[model samples]
Target: MVADEKKIFGHPRGLPWLFFIEMWERLAFYTMLNVLLLYAKDFERGGLALPSGQANEIYGFYLAFVYFTPFVGGILADRMLGYRRSVLIGGLVMAGGLIAMSVPGTTFFYSGLVLLVLGNGLFKPNISVMVGNLYAAGDPKRDSGFNIFYMGINIGAFLASFLSSGIRNTYGWLMVFRVAGFGLILGVIILLLGWKVLAHADRQPEKDPNDAGFGAVAGKILMPALVVGVITYVIANKFIPDFAVTPATMGFIIGMIPVIIYFIRLPRTVSDKERPGMFALLPIYVAGGTFFMVLHLNGSAMTQWAADDTARDIAAPAAFQQDALPTYYKNAGEDVPRPAEANLVVVEDPAVVRMFGQKRMDEQTLAQITARYPELELRDFDPKAQATDFSGEEAALFQFATAIYADGKVEVVEEKDAHGVPSYSAKIPEREPALRRVAFMRKTPGGEVFPTYLVTQDSFDEIYSGYEARFGHPPEQLEPGKWLPVINPELFQSLNALFVVAFTPLIVLLFGWISARKNVTTAQKVFYGLCLTTVSLLLMALAGLASDGGAMRVSGWWLVGFYAIITAGELLISPMGLSLVTKLAPKRLVGLAMGGWFLATAFGNKFSGFFGGIQHMMSPVAFFLVLAGLAAAVAVFIRLLLPKLDAAIEGLS
Candidate 1:
């Protein structure tokens, strides 16, 4: 049961290197992730310019596989490459993939994403084993070292958003992705240079008699799964036209059948003494799986909210800061021009909103307004900035956006410079101009409602300044409101990481005190962690309501609060789960078990994309609430069963 006996910082010296490597890896991953969707639909600005639903769905699928495949990586590394070799290979491959993603071609983009996925698989699980190797068995600092390492991961995540957004907005999308690749390369290089140092960590584990080689396993499961998945997708897409199937989703679902069966049958196949422990862990793992799905969605679903729905406008642009902080408030309307939205901003009456500060425009009416403002360049507008916008039509014939977002209003405060003194200014009559106009169709079917929005000349002048990433256009002259007051969508991606960094020390201290008091148990920490995740989700649900039904963007503080709260849960659960995997796994099957833990994580991660894909059907409040409720249920389950689970671990330990 003895692990490495070395000591550095009261723990293994090599731990820091692994810690930093993981930190950098997460940084690059989160950085590239922060702006991925925005780049996808960027169109002329080096984006694919797809529908939000499609973009989110694809995003979800990508994350799912990225996490899921690591099971295979852990296996390969344990059986053949060993942890260090696997980590090196994964890092190099990921670096190449990230670089390739910047190539700006459709093929290369997919290729890069695929490489990241495979590379992540190889590197993710084995690294955990390395961390364990740094500590002798039963060392108290083992968990603490992991917590420190976890901090490194979050540090990178916290910084990555700034790096990614700064690069993309300031430079270009290509540079942003290229920087992400550089991060991966740096991680690999650092680890390789310190190879001698980390060599004390996990080496190649012995293969079990039951361990089937890759070819035999891949042929038995992978080949058949691919063939079946393809046929199923084709048939679903064609004959059962109503039942469409995505290859990634179907392939993943079917591919898991063999793995699922393997896990289910393992307990029965193993000796009876291990049966109770294995059976007890199943629910814990399932619950953990569900929790991670919601938690991991931060990189996917929550990122969507930040990019599109959350308020991203920085209030004090250079122009407003010239005088005082309240200047933006004083000049609420006069100087703040509401710019018309281009065809590119994915909201209703984008043009009308430009004409009018906050008005409802039917699809058709908005199109007419846009056609009127033909001089404006819609192509340069950032799609992720606004929650909604003016559409191609006036918006009468069809309900273009979801009902939750159809009637949202973004606050516009204009700043007026009087006598060289700046004050808040806004356009307001005795009765505010109707920004949201629900007009009845004058035609025979007049009951059908047609909504109209405006594209005020003032609005147009203001919005165009925020977008600076396009090849020809940059928001160089920081206007009163940073152009459109569009949210810096990527900034929202960092909220969770920010919370992690902010709260990690506190949580670590809390746990340290608890363990010192002889009151802390892994099971208790895990149960509480689930509770925290539930609370975090509930906080997000509250944030949605505060948005006033998608009319206004909530404060970034809301994001900060949720992330901070949830991080406590993450600190408790993620590390504990890793420890449990190491402790409970039989030596002969530890790698596979490690893969199992990661596979559970992969399941949750993939489900995040699935949930993200169907974002339109549910309101943000409801969307987050469902997940919160699920977490609560799981927490309750864990609390009820903590005694038995603890005993099982105690016996094993």
Candidate 2:
């Protein structure tokens, strides 16, 4: 398999082919993932506007299944389709899914998520197995090869942040999905072009009489798991109706029970020599499950932290500065200035204020909306009550009225049909001086004009309360020129990938240097990684404390520090664990073993969602501390198992 011995940076030539293919695939994967939660909960940006808990549940299940499918994909590739064909099939299917997601409809969006989960199952595991195949048995370069391959993943992930931000900012969310689909297409093209170079790494399907057939595994494993999951769902609904966790989550957890039993019984069926290796993987799976449970939070709870609790008021260079979204002021500190009170039109009705959170419509738009819904009620805004010379946080008290409008940028409250598909319609009451709220307009550098509105006190929920508690008076006011650029919350998702790219080389070198002097095993590295993960969560818990359990906004630097620490831990665990799987799994069972690795990841990812779904139930400090304690407990468990894990790969590496 290692023929044509040409090397790319002292590793097999196939490394580069796999590297670039994975790079582009991850770019597409992460580009969609980073914004899924935000888009789900967004109101103004053509998003689903689902509640945070529901969105977190969806995100978690998506991530869990995406990793879960690899188990089936791995078996199919190992026993039927070779790695190369599987990779191509996955790429094409995933591209179609991304394109589907770009289409406007909840049906298309969910259908696309299903496609993504299926595609990732086929794509994710086979490629890594191919990377392992490039090196002969017990080759020292294997670990380093995995390290280099991991960089490709992070490089794509690093770029995804900017690509998602730019495409989402300039075009919209749908366009972001469209662009990601095209990126996957490019990766498939690269794979096609490098087919000959990667040929040596593609092995024929195994023909082992001793191995269990895919059908046997599916019947004994998959079908029973599904039945158990359904039964769990039914029972939970019937009995634990008031359970803190969602029934679906409880079902998923319960379903994994049989799979866990299968894994526990697996070693008994293996040859005596291979039994220890099979047993060793169980602890390794535990370690992986624990680590990913925390690491995957980037898309859920952590993203929520960035969006809601963190201060993102970093000043952009003059060329990039523009009017921020109305939601930005909700958590913005007193340092960020409020628009002049004269700029706001005061609406007495609280219901009207809630309908248009911070929206403004011009006279023509208002006239069109009123004409379309003439049966709607009308309200008159007082003309002489304009408090022109106002300053301070008190100015947020002003609310503007508007008839419903949606010309791409404008938001109108949504309605759902009997079939549960969302359609836009709001009974926006007509107001006097139709253009009152549109008095202030901000123009983008591209010369596009959009109306901006100051946040009403009701809209500035936590910020208003925090200001009132801190300073019995409204804070000092600065005029328009002193404005700060509000960084999009989704862009912060990139920090983890950025830190991975930045830290990989240093980590690789340090690990090499350490191994040269001392016999530090892969198990020890995972143990240390879990310890660091615990520390990172503790750091975030402290930040939650500083913010008074999310009553105040903290600087974005806290997020920066969190990513830096956890990424260092990620490098130690993820790639090393992948390399360890290759070293320890029986040659015939490599694909299944890889699938098993991802199955553990699926469990971890599901729990990540479980925690995220429950996030709003607890204060920030308690939430972060609970995660920190879980990580610490896992680290201790891993520490107890290190000797056995180290022994499993003792001679192989």
Q: Which stretches of candidate 1 lie over 4 Å from their true place?
A: 239-251, 271-277, 315-337, 340-482, 485-487
For each candidate, what TM-score against the reference? Answer: 0.75, 0.85
Q: What is candidate 1's lDDT per residue for 1-653, written digit by digit as tens?
A: 34555667677779889988998898889888877766664322325544455566567777777767776886787678888988898888899999998874567888999999999888888888788777765677777877788888889998997787656544456778889998988898889888988888866567766656677657865577667767766665566643333455665677677776666666675556666566665666766687788877776677766654564455633211111111121112223333223212222433333223222223454455446544322222222222123332421112212111122232223322112222221222322223333321211133422222222333334344422222236333322212344435567667777777777778878877877878788878889889889998999899888865554556678877777788778888888887777666665555666778777777787777777766545788888888888889889988888888888888876
Q: Give the Å error, residue 19, model 2.
A: 0.9
In model 1, the worst 10-residue window by lDDT is 319-328
lDDT of each: 0.64, 0.76
Q: Judged by lDDT, which candidate is best?
A: 2
Per-residue lDDT for 421-512 in model 2, tens only?
Answer: 44342233333232243223434456543333433455554344555566575645435323345677777778999999899899989988
Residue ranges of candidate 2 with Cα displaced over 4 Å:
2-4, 317-323, 340-457, 460-469, 475-484, 651-653
What is the lDDT for 120 in model 2?
92
